[model samples]
Target: MDATAPPPLPTRGPAGSPRGGQDDAAQLQLLSVLHYVMAGFTALFSLFPVIYLVLGIAVLSGAMPVDSSTASSPGEVQLMGWVFTGLGTVFFLAMLATAGLVGYAGRCLAREQRHTLCMVAAGVCCMFMPLGTILGVFTLVTLTRTSVRQRFAHGAALPPSTH
Candidate 1:
């Protein structure tokens, strides 16, 4: 061994390669996946209100019975049914729209495009709590990195392989 020779460069791990670019890319990818999963859940839960509206209608129509002791008059039952239906429709549409936006943001994040839009979506995700909070924070942190910003600027679909 030559003492005067420069020390060998550190070997990069599979994920830590790409001049430290892969780490950010991987984090973004994970965040994107989380957004997608959250979107699916949002969409699924949005249907619950619709189902409630349907059941309400059925009860009002007498197809499903209500106990006589607790039952309101037909007019009152009809009004309640309408209210549920209206509220359910509004909630369903709103949640579906939210899910669509999040899903679109996830796709853009995975492609390393639309940085500002992804950041906005992530911020919105932060409002949802629990899973969204985790995903949103991670997304914000990863997307704010200098390297990640450069990757977006370069419009690269994926990080270059170090091999």
Candidate 2:
């Protein structure tokens, strides 16, 4: 119990060492890992649309027949195939692109760079439901913090602390 007990250190502690950023560092590391995992899941789900693509190809190739009861002519069947193909391709490609962005954002976070990219990725991730929403919300919250923003600005990895 001494008045000279060093005044409890500044809120930011030191110049190069973030003394107060330990929590932010840990949270960023965890979020980055989660982003990578989410990216993988998104990429995996993107393949589901390939089923539609394959079915479309089959219809277009004449391997699949159209029901006379449903379609008036062969032309209608071909058009249907095109619709499926186009929609499937669009969804698949879009999801894959999103997955890539999420993964890249995660890398940026880990490296403490590209704060804008990370924020953008988080917002995009929010479009997804449930899990993605959770991750996105958490990421958005973490990135909005003052200390975290400063860390991102520094663009330097926090040194591992030895207790």
Candidate 3:
């Protein structure tokens, strides 16, 4: 090959080959799976606060017994109930929204479209900790790579093979 010739384009290899576009596709696949798992957890966990609020309201309304010493005045109890209800609703809604955004980003990443939007969504996921942190870091690293960016920008002529 001529010294000045550019490197040959990489071919899709057998599963687990360490090639440029293949690596980017694998990373995108991983990100999609992570986002899906996170979305399920977010939807499931969001219900917990709602359940707690309902139980608390029942206790405050005298449908459930409370320790006499720990009980507050009826007015105070009502106020606390209202506050918890509002906060729990906000938290539940926020979690659902985050889940939706992450899921959408995953779809975009898989299709190799809206690259910048996917990066921003991944950055937001980083704030969530644990799984989100892992996914976000991997996403940022993979998507920022020149080869990956080019793949996303120009669109892949063929979908990466799973096997």
Q: Candidate 1 — which residues are off by over 4 angstroms?
A: 1-17, 59-62, 65-74, 159-163
**RMSD after Cα superposition, model 3:** 6.4
Model 2 stretches with alpha carbons more than 4 Å out: 1-19, 158-163
TM-score of each: 0.74, 0.85, 0.73
lDDT of each: 0.82, 0.90, 0.78
**Would you give me the overall lDDT of model 2?**
0.90
Candidate 1 lDDT tens digits, 25-78: 777788788889989988888887888678767766778766666646766767
Give the worst 10-residue stretch by lDDT in candidate 2.
9-18
Sort the predicted structures by lDDT, highest score first. 2, 1, 3
Highest-lDDT candidate: 2
Query: Model 2: clashing residue pairs?
Result: none
Q: Which window of 10 residues has the lowest lDDT sum in candidate 3?
A: 12-21
For residue 2, model 1's alpha carbon misses the true position, in angstroms, by 15
User: Any residue pairs clashing in model 1, and if so which?
Assistant: none
lDDT of 2 by residue, 32-109 (tens): 999999999999999999999989999999898778899988889989999989999999999999999999999888
